[model samples]
Target chain A: MKELEDRIRRDGTIKPGNVLKVDAFLNHQCDVALFDAMGAHWAQLFAGRQIDKILTIEASGIGIACVAARHFGNVPVVFAKKTQSINLDGDQYVSSIYSFTKQREYPVIVAKRFLQAGEHVLLIDDFLAKGNALHGLIDICKHAGVIVEGIGIAIEKGFQEGGSKLRKEGYDVKSLAIVEKMDADTGNIEFATTD
Target chain B: MKELEDRIRRDGTIKPGNVLKVDAFLNHQCDVALFDAMGAHWAQLFAGRQIDKILTIEASGIGIACVAARHFGNVPVVFAKKTQSINLDGDQYVSSIYSFTKQREYPVIVAKRFLQAGEHVLLIDDFLAKGNALHGLIDICKHAGVIVEGIGIAIEKGFQEGGSKLRKEGYDVKSLAIVEKMDADTGNIEFATTD
Candidate 1:
């Protein structure tokens, strides 16, 4: 966790409108080694919990979740597709979410056969800001009749309501790096102290 | 390679219109253990090549490329974005491609900073049908002035022109399982014999 926090401090850029650009290492260009370490940290935090599958959204979360799946005993990682494709046929659990980054609302889809009833799932994502994406994934899990074991986030914006709201709703959320405050003009950032 | 061929024969489904769906383990719901094996196989095939980065497209390719990066000494995996986002700012290498699955023309974008001139890159993808997506990635690599050491593909539809075309272009292509023929009605699949 400290390694991730440090890496974010050194490489991450604070942009206008609270936009933290970590594309250099986090999302667009991925650091698989760091992802593996984050996965190990989550495995420790969620120890003793039954995680049958790792669920994530497509594009960004796919890489991190797949790399982390190794640490989770190579569980199947089901990435919810953001758009409907001809390949995506048959019954599916669908949930819609608005992405501020993409500036549009899109449907998150997962094939129904992949998620069975009573299966324990761990949700993983790159960032947790407004929590809309996480909420959409949670909605699909509910419809699929699966049990949510825990949520693993790479970075959480502490100033935002997403992380706190999820925690208050009785979700076990473990975010490796939480940005408490960030300055666009001075390019300064602060992280929440976690034990 | 035999292991991958065996898995595809076991879990891969053949749909109408020449659609071979391996979503059960390969793309939609990923089997990371199997992916690890595929990665090891590619590492063996593309061994001795100087690969500084792993380049791939978003959604499906990210997981395979990220997991495979470990076999390449944990190289950085850079996935080209399929859509424009507010997070994607500054200079970029852009190419357009038409997706048969999505039934639309989309832009393949890679940030200019991640790719450096003369850097050796290995292109990885989940499926190589018509090679439209792979071509887009290769176009960006060309514009960025990166050297493509090799191309690693999980599955290639040998009946399609993509794999053959890329091979004809003098690329070192290593496909784990090459589907020579498939029957949708009978659900029978055959792989091209390889040495």
Candidate 2:
């Protein structure tokens, strides 16, 4: 976790409007080794919990979740699709979320057969800001009747309400790096102290 | 390679209109263990190549490429984005491609900073059907002036012209499972024999 926090400090850029650009290493261009380490940290944090599958949203979370799946004993990683495709047929658990990054609302879809009742699933994502995406994934999990074992986040905006809201809702949220404050003009960033 | 072929034969579904769905393990719901095996196989096939990075598209290819990057010494995996986002700022290498599955023309975008001139890249994808997606990635690679060391494909529809055409273009293509023929009615799929 310290490694991740350090990496973010060194490589991450703080933009105006609280936009933290980590595309250099986290999302667009992935550091799989870092992802593996994050996975290991989550495995330690969520030890003793049953994680049958890893549920994440598409485009960004797929890489991190898949790499982290190795730490979770290679559990199946089901990425919820943002767009509907012809390939996505049959019964599906659908939930809609609004993405500020993309500036649009899109449906998160997972095939029904992929999620079975009573399965314990670990939710993983790159960032937790407004928690709209997490809420959508949680909604799908609810519809599928799957148990939410835990939530693993690579980076969480501590100033935002997403992480706190989820924690208050009885969800075990483990974020490796939480940005407490960031400055756009001075390019300075601060992280929340976690034990 | 045999492990991948076997898994495909077992879990892959043949739908009408020549659709071979391996979503059960490959794309939608990913089997990371199987993906690790496929990564190892590609490592063997593309051995001795100077692979500086693994380039792929978003959604499906990100997981496979990121997991496979470990076999390539944990190289950075850069996935091209299909849609424009506020997070995706600055200069980028953009190319348009038509997706048969999504039934729309989308842009494949890679940030210019992620790719450097003369860097050797290995293109990885989940499927190589008509090669539209690969072509888009290759175009972006050309714009970025990166050397494509090889192309690693999880599955290739040999009946389609994509794989053959890419091979004709003098690319070192290694497809784990090449479906030479498939029957939708009978749900039988056959792979092309390889060494």
Candidate 3:
């Protein structure tokens, strides 16, 4: 977690709309070594827990979820696809979610056979802003009869209410690096206390 | 590679239109243990080579690339984004690619800083059919002045022209499992000889 925070501070560039660009290491260009370490951290945090699978949304979350699964006893990882491809079978468990970043609503889906009833799912993602994507995944889990064990996020915009709202509802949400505050003018990133 | 061949034969489904769906493990619902084995396999095939980074495309390729990177000495893995997002900044090397799967001409972008000149890059992907995505990533490397050491594919539709073309051109292409033919009636899959 400290390595992630340090990497974010060293390479994360602040843009106009509260955007912390970690494309250098977190998103576009990934540090697999760091990913393994983070996976170890998650394994430690979720030790002695019954996690049957790791579920995440497509694109950015896939890489993190894959590496993290190595630590979580090599559990299977199911990523909800953002778009329904022509090759994708017609039958699926679907949920609609709004992307606050893109300012649009998209349907997220997974093959019905993947997520089974009573399966304990650990939801993972790269960033949590308004919590729309996380909730969408949770909705799909609900439809599939899967239990949402907990949520694991790499970076959370703590100023936003997404993290707090989920915690208030008694959901176990774990975040590695949280940006408490950011200033574009000064290029400052304030991290939240781990506890 | 035999293990991968067995997985495809056992779990892979052949659809009507020459679609080989291995979403159960390779892409959608990822098996981390198998991914580790795959990473090790790739490492053995590309042994004694200096690989600085692993490049791949979004969605399916991320998981494979992340796991494969562990075997490549935990090299940094970079995935080109298929969609535009607010998080991706202005400074980027972009390439336009046409996806037959979705029937669209969209742009894939990588942070300009991710791929550096003179770095040895190994392109890894889930499927190599028409080789459009692989070519696009290779073009990005050309634009960025990076050296493409080789290309690693999990599965290659040998009936397609993608593999043959790359092989003709003398590119170091290694497909873990190459499917020569598939019969939906008999539920049979034939893997081509890599030797």
Clash-forming residue pairs, model 1: none
Error of 2 at A16 (Å): 0.4
The digit string of per-residue lDDT tens for model 1 on A1-195 reads: 799999988999989999999998999999999999999999999999999999999889999999999888999999999989888999999999999999999999999999999999999999999999999999999999999999999999999999999999999999999999999999888999763
Q: lDDT score, residue B36, model 1?
A: 92
Q: Can you write out model 2's per-residue Cα lDDT over B1-195, one digit (the tens) per residue?
A: 788889888998899988989899988999999889889989999889999999999989999999999999999999999999989999989999999999999999999999999999999999999999999999999889999999999999999999999999999898888999999988788889764
- How good is the docking of model 3, as DockQ? 0.83
Candidate 3 chain B lowest-lDDT run of ten: B84-93
DockQ-derived CAPRI band for the predicted complex in model 2: high
Q: All models: lDDT?
A: 0.94, 0.93, 0.89
Clashing pairs in 2: none
Superposed on all Cα atoms, model 1 deviates from the true structure by an RMSD in Å of 0.8
Which ranking of candidates, highest DockQ first?
1, 2, 3
User: In model 1 chain A, where is the ten-residue run with the lowest total lDDT?
Assistant: A186-195
Clashes of each: 0, 0, 0
DockQ of each: 0.96, 0.95, 0.83
**lDDT digits (tens) for residues B59-128 of candidate 3:** 7999999988989888999999988888776678889888877789888888887888999999999999
- Per-residue error (Å), model 1, residue B43: 0.6
Worst lDDT 10-window in candidate 3 chain A: A82-91
